[model samples]
Target: METVKLYVIVFDSTHSAIAAETMLKEENIANEVIPTPREITASCGLSIRFNIDSLDKVKNILKQGSVSVNGVYKLERRLNEKQVEKLM
Candidate 1:
């Protein structure tokens, strides 16, 4: 099986998550608003998942917007196993 790597931006609230999703969409960035993965102990239930290449753009949009962020995380999945790490 192949490994899948992605990054997730955990927001502080649902509103922030939704707002971030909109901002990313406006920039033509590919993203998905997913339930905050159980592996990440965050305050909110929503997170935006995007590819590594879009990290900088996502960060810039979040910084420019009023969204409250918890942190950024790196997620790696291979077969039935997965790894998670806090990057920010």
Candidate 2:
């Protein structure tokens, strides 16, 4: 199966988003904090997107730590030939 590349995770608050980032980093998970993409509805307007492979572990961490993530989505961006070629 093809590997999924993107994710959008919404938090209950900006502080929770930041805390989640710190926790993920401490556990050696790679991710980024970004404004909530239009596709997702959230009050905090901040979220974390990380590699798809880390989805389960990240969700577990959030649940265990009481970090309320409103939603999660798998996202993919189309790569033009030039971009695809560069990666090859």
Report the C-alpha lDDT of model 2 over 1-88, residue by residue, as the tens digit: 4433558677788888998999999999999998876655544899787886887888788778867667776654455211111110
How far off is model 1, as Cα RMSD? 1.4
Instruction: Please list the residue runs of candidate 1 whose C-alpha ends up more than 4 Å from where it truly belongs after superposition.
Output: none
lDDT digits (tens) for residues 12-85 of candidate 1: 88988888888899999999998888888865888888989988887888888888899989999899898999
Model 1: what TM-score?
Answer: 0.88
Winning model by lDDT: 1
What stretches of model 2 exceed 4 Å from their correct place?
A: 1-5, 77-88
- Per-model TM-score, in order, reads 0.88, 0.75
User: Candidate 2's C-alpha lDDT?
Assistant: 0.72
Give the lDDT of residue 35 in candidate 2.
Answer: 86
Worst 10 residues of 1 by lDDT: 34-43
Reference-based lDDT, residue 51, model 2: 82
Worst 10 residues of 2 by lDDT: 79-88
